[model samples]
Target chain A: MICLSLFLSFLQIGLFSFGGGYAAMPLIQEQVVTLHGWLSMETFADLVTISEMTPGPIAVNAATFVGTQTAGFAGAVAATLGCVLPSCLFVTLLAFIYTRCRSLPILQQTLASLRPAVVSMIAKAGLTILISAFFLDGTASLIRENISVRMIVWFAAALFLLRKKKWNPILVMALCGICEAAFCAV
Target chain B: MEIFQKKQRLPVLLRLFTSTLYLSAFTFGGGYVIVTLLKNTFVDKYHWISEEEMLDLTAIAQSAPGAVAVNGAAAVGCRIAGIPGVLASVLGAVIPPMAILSLVSLCYTVFCSNPWISAALNGMKAGVGAVITSVVWDMSSRIVRSKDPANTLILILSFCLCWFGGVNVICIILAAAAFGVLRSLHAKKGGSAA
Candidate 1:
């Protein structure tokens, strides 16, 4: 039953997750944290964190992690298949039609409108995660109690290095990890 | 001749599978970044696809649902080898992430509660948040490039709807699609594609 539900839920996510992984974040969050109670909110945030640190698409990683937690390896397979099967089924057909009608005015305009809306969806999902990470604890209160000033400083520095300094992403994440470990040891 | 063609095709499929596996396993940040990596492998390295075809594939892949990286891989695979190509490509994409996440799920929860490990995880969480922030800004800036008042309005409206308005995203997107369909009378209207 658990596996079946996981598969169905992820299938829904895969189908509706337009605008790529980032756009899918909100829907994934709502389903995993709010609707199913499979993972706690903090745990869900942690899932997002680990998902980012690892490779593959966010949606796929999320499904696998949550599935593994809930029902084990078989659950993981079911959930992953759920996430992927929709894409495999649709893209082949959609791409063929889209390629055939590349210049259809309706497609172009729909895409144009979608582009901005996609941006907004990303912003909202990103902001939700950002706020939860930066400002929430077990219970999010506008400003999370556990968020230390040091953590904020480290976050900002890492962002600077990755963005303006153009440092390697792995190195930046490692630096944060090491700094956090060192401070915790004290 | 068909048998000979089958013999010729094996290596092509094998190469597509291995390269996608390598990228899926190694690349991080998000699927969008793989666009460049795919270019390097398929175009620069193997010469399987032309730069223009990659561009077209990427556009179509991006417009479709699912992860861009996965869609991009599937699209390229289809272009290069058809259905078998897609299977090879997608299987490559999922295997690495599945393996890694499974490991994390099995062991990390036990370690996560340790004070030091907890701290590192928290810091990592913060780092992830920062990366997401950068992505949002980057995407938003590009969208605003078209300078369409309607685009800006929709951008704000969608954000407000999703973030504060409590509107379901599917409805917001559908509404935008309908608006576009209705207002598409003037392609000359300056709404540049993001």
Candidate 2:
């Protein structure tokens, strides 16, 4: 039963989430917190923290954590496989079709329509994560309390450095994390 | 003898292995950062696909399954190479973290209450929050710039529903899908009537 739940939750995450791992957060939050009752909101938040800190996609982190919590190591494998299986299967199939229809106008039109929908899904996922992060308990305390101001400023600075100044991402993330630790201590 | 020519595919495997290492080592800010790196390597550096194709592939990858970064990498690999590419990319993405986590999990049990590690993680949490916020802003600007009122409205509603109302995201996704489909149909019907 635990295995089944892990499979289904990840499968749902795989099918519905658009725009990537961050976009899957709300769906993951819902499944882990509200539906399955496997983890608490606080734990989910903690998982998000770990997921962001660790190297890999958020979905994979969630799968590993949730699977481990529910059914040990095997559960972790089950969840990870469940999450990634869709991508593996879809890409392979799409590859086959793409080769055959690389020049078809009708296929192109269908893909065109699908683009806006994909954009919308990605947008929605972003909104969900923003809300989850900054506006907990139906309040924007993260901003109002000024707890996140410095962090935001540093994040913007990092973004500028990465985009405009062409800095490396690893350096930026490390610097930001260091700055954050310093500020919090002060 | 000519018909049985054995093509050397070792370079492809090496590329896949290296990419996997890069992903596991450098992906700290989650999926979007990985995607950006992928764009740098696959699209800009390698010229595997055009920028437009990359965006389309990203969309499809996000909507498919697994981690978006891994999925995107696999899609690009399959597109550029073949089944071998898929294996190489996925293995590249999954292996490092899996090994690291196994070690961490072992140590974590021993250090569950270590003050230094705990404090470090607490500080890291704040950084994670900041990273997530940056991801949201980056994605929103890239994907939600239409002047369409309906799109704008849906964005606002979805934010409010999830953030304030605490509505289930699965329901919100379904609602958004239905709303988009119905709106598109209505626009088509109105166009025909005119």
lDDT of 2 by residue, B79-191 (tens): 66677777788778876666555455445444544445443444333334444445445544644664555555665676677656866544565566566556666766888
Model 2's i-RMS, to one decimal, reads 5.7
Which 10-residue window of candidate 1 chain B scores lowest in summed lDDT? B1-10
TM-score of the A-chain for all models = 0.55, 0.58
Candidate 1 chain A: worst 10 consecutive residues by lDDT? Answer: A136-145
* Candidate 2 lDDT, A5-82, residue by residue in tens: 798888888666665666789999988889999888987876776665467877777887888878888888777777
In candidate 1, what are the lDDT values of residues A1-186, reduced to their tens digit?
999999999999988998776788998998888999999998888888777666788999999999998999999999999988878777676656655675788877776776677667656654654555566463346553565677778889988986898665545666887788898898
Q: Report the CAPRI category for model 2.
A: acceptable
Clashing pairs in 2: B20-B92
> For each candidate, how many residue pairs have backbone atoms clashing (under 3 Å)?
1, 1
How does candidate 1 score on lDDT? 0.74
